[model samples]
Target chain A: MALDIPSPAALQLTASPAAVSAALTTTQVRVTSSFRGARIVLYGAVFDPSTTPSDVVVIVRGPDLPVRIARKTKVAGVWVNSRPVVFRGAPGFYMTASTRPLADIAGFGTLRRLGAGIDHLAINAPLEQHTETRYGVRDVVVSRLGADYLDWRRAVVRLKENAGLYDADDKGVTFVDKDLFKAEIDLPTEAPTGRYQAEIILFQDGQPVSRKVRSLTVEKAGIERTLYLFAHRSPWLYGLVSMALALGAGWAASLAFRRN
Target chain B: MDLYLPIAEVSVNAPLLVALGALVGFISGLFGIGGGFLMTPVLVLMGIPPAVAVASMANHVAASSTSSVISYTRKRAVDFRMGGVLAAGGVAGAIVGVEVFRWLRLMGQADLVVALSYLVFLGVIGGLMLVESLQSILRRRSGQPPKPRKDRRPPWLYSLPLKMRFPRSRLYISVIPPVLLGVFVGVLSAVMGVGGGFVLVPAMVYILRMPAGVVVGTSLFQIIITTSLTGVLQAGRNQTVDIVLATLLLVGGVLGAQLGAKASSRFRAEELRALLALIVLLVGLRMGLGLFFTPDEPFILMTGMG
Candidate 1:
């Protein structure tokens, strides 16, 4: 089913093909015993035949969770973590891919409004709303600390990027023809298991004409899944079982070595 | 072959992990000490998270120590009464240690504290052992009689109450020393993610005046209990113990310990102590250097701590 909506720009927006406007090659990611990483291919066709697709940007984001970014400073001849910034809702995994450079496709204001890039993500600290305290940073008012806030935010992005959980690739998306485009997204081995959302935005004349969002489930499967569930669900039992296994293994090893 | 760790949530090479376990196990067997000090660092270097590395290494230590304990028991080398008293104190220390560990983690100083403690402890213990062993070796080579050990037991140890007899170790010292020693080792085991046998062995030899033959077995018995406790607590509290990873390491470690125990009989005691001292000193030096060196990345991102 296609949804045709009129944009404020008075442009007709439609996501097609109606049956499957945007689809992921696999809706589920299974983490088995030998799982290293996985690749996801997202493909779709823009239905606005009247106007050629100027830009296609695909954004994939993993489940959001609280994250803490810390900067280390040398203290008393040892490096110690200082000045920690805690983000209340940070994506565990994020990637942005586009047909061309994002700056070349649309203006910064439009891109930020659409939340199409890392800089536009709505991540905030716990005390962001309080003007007096401003996220536990001592004596720094929120209105006066714009530059410091940007620095902390940039630090978050830089650290996450180094951790292989956040990425951006301007050349990741390619157009097969006039209307069909595809993007490849990589899920690193350390990626957290959760629901991931992929949004395909069709831009014409540097304006977003249509957008389609699809979700994929990434979860552990088989023995991996069972173990993870057991550990989280009944941690006491898991601990007991682990201890018993360790004890038994040691005993068995002793017996085996004694024979030799 | 690649194997996925359920708890750590990472895939790693199975054989490489096993090889690392074997290498550490051989050293433990040859030196009569738990190998956690070496194993934990190697696992962290192999891209495993530091928390997971510490927890899983505890499990590996428990298993390896058990195997050695069995062998030592068969040879009548273990002082069970002393081990029991030490373990009793160790359990209490481990409980307190876990709380301290949690507090340090909240303050974001867990890594720094653990690393610093490791460097200081290893440096002092390794340096002392090296000098003592070298002196003994030189005396033998020069055809001089070995110097008599001084009555170095502190005055406080003699005055403590609750004295007990340990016939196996030929000591009638107060039980307070062994118990307090166990408590100190337990704290080290929890915070530094080591079995604490490195500290225990030297303490028993120099302070408690236990026979060298009995020290190894008694230390292994205490290690088995304390590390097992640490592993269980870490699994329950932090969910950081990776069972699959521990199993791979244990498999190789058990075999290597057997070979190491066999080779232990071949080397002279002074030479073995000297070699162990060198290894400990090297590890300490490396960690100590880390404190002074500037890291390539000054920023780090952590999850599940907000």
Candidate 2:
């Protein structure tokens, strides 16, 4: 629960001299055995605020992990999973917060390129690679499955959303002062351990003027970390230990009963 | 309080998990059953991944059976020789079962297969037990002596090769039948994350014609080895066993089992069997209903399969 804010790195000055920088309340999150969930605040300031009104968009994304979406179909009398679609680089956690609606802040092309909105988010998958130019970038996401692929994509989002992993809020980013703003992102207990990225973008005139990226680490700590490493690193030994523990406990219980 | 399971990677209520373990353990002790069939499904219902629930329950079974085996050993009820043969066959079955489990997981049918297995086995076993127990209860109520069970083994059992003499059970049976029985039970243990005692005990009494005195002990002896082996393989190969979760269950199970054992003397055997049968049938029916009913969410999402 302790917050350790690391000094924010200055971003490159854009042509307009407007630079947006952000820092998380904690640069690292240690998920202990008692970890339920955590709320992290990404606070930053936009320097040299222009006379023209601008919007701030904050995105916090977890590490890419492969996910499979299996659709169930009736087989005989029981329903069973049939076709499965695998997304190779689905973010384990994704939260997007903006001062205003992303569509109103920037054009579709800009948001798609930035991957700012939930709908505009691009998840990588193994698909036929005939690319079409869209939003000044080759869109590899649109594949032979075509419109059908969107169903699978939507399934992933819906499931993640239900799990409280993927989240979006049009007005989650609040400006506390003339240039100081903060965005809160909630990390669920089921969030995967890995590196997370927080990106703060300043949009003006329907275009992103300045962007800054900050990295955060979420990892198992204390007994949780040790056990996770032991289980994965030397599973055979761990298994033996598990057997031994069971045997010992069973023997102890029997002895206790006998003594009584 | 919520505690995160390292391997399962999910936060769950610590007290709730312990209570679940205690409940399963108490039932197992009261009925002299392994309780894996009950434990696995309940864990899954509590949102533990199916694979983790199954693998971890194997470890729990190992502990519970060990407790029973120790008591049986003190009373000279266990047939170590018979248990060894069964264990050998069980180990072989477990090896094959784990591989099949892995393949099912890859095909994304592990959950379906597990549910079906539980539904079928629990249903058949529960129904048979209910009918048999009810008949016995009625006979006792009418002051009629129960019909004596036929002690004769099937002719086919004697016709098998590699016959062995088991002085403990005072039976001369073919080694092949016992070994094959062991193998079948072992596969069940591995795939279903059960102790397989429910099946093993009945098979030994009727098919092998083992003495009723040695049946429970011999089954427990086999269960300990098979479930321990299954636990190890599951942990090493599938990495599905959650040691922390296993430990919590053990703490509650050991204590609950001792209390249940103490309480068992007060209950009538026939009545207990009938109650156990009813509980089993209810769990089985619940699982079966899940299969037949349409899910609100037709899509199942899995992460970290890459």
List per-candidate RMSD values in Å: 3.9, 4.1
Per-candidate total of colliding backbone pairs: 0, 0
Compose the digit string of candidate 1's lDDT tens values, residues A1-260.
11122233443444433211678999899999989989999888766535454678888888887777676789988887775567755688889999898888889988877766888787777564455544676655453225567777787878778778899999988878766888899999988888888878777778776677788988999999998888888877887788788778878988987887
Evaluated on CA atoms against the true complex, candidate 1 attains a DockQ of: 0.65
Using alpha carbons, what is the TM-score of model 2?
Answer: 0.93
The residue-by-residue lDDT of candidate 2 on B114-195, one tens digit each, is 8788788888888988998999999999999987989777999888788888888887778898888889888888888899
- The per-model DockQ list reads 0.65, 0.68
lDDT of 1: 0.82
**In model 1, what is the error at residue B171, expressed in angstroms?**
1.4
Tell me the whole-model lDDT of each prediction, alpha carbons only: 0.82, 0.83
Query: Could you tell me the TM-score of chain B in model 1?
Result: 0.96
**What interface RMSD do all candidates show, one decimal each?**
1.4, 1.1
| Per-residue lDDT of candidate 1, residues B1-306 (tens digit) | 999999888889999988988888888888888899888877877878787888888889988888788999999999999999999888888877877887777777777887788789999999999999999999999999989877577777778888898999988788888898999888888888899998999889888888878999999999999988988888888787888989999988887887888899999999999999999988877866687788887777654456
Q: Which regions of candidate 2 are displaced past 4 Å?
A: A1-14, A127-147
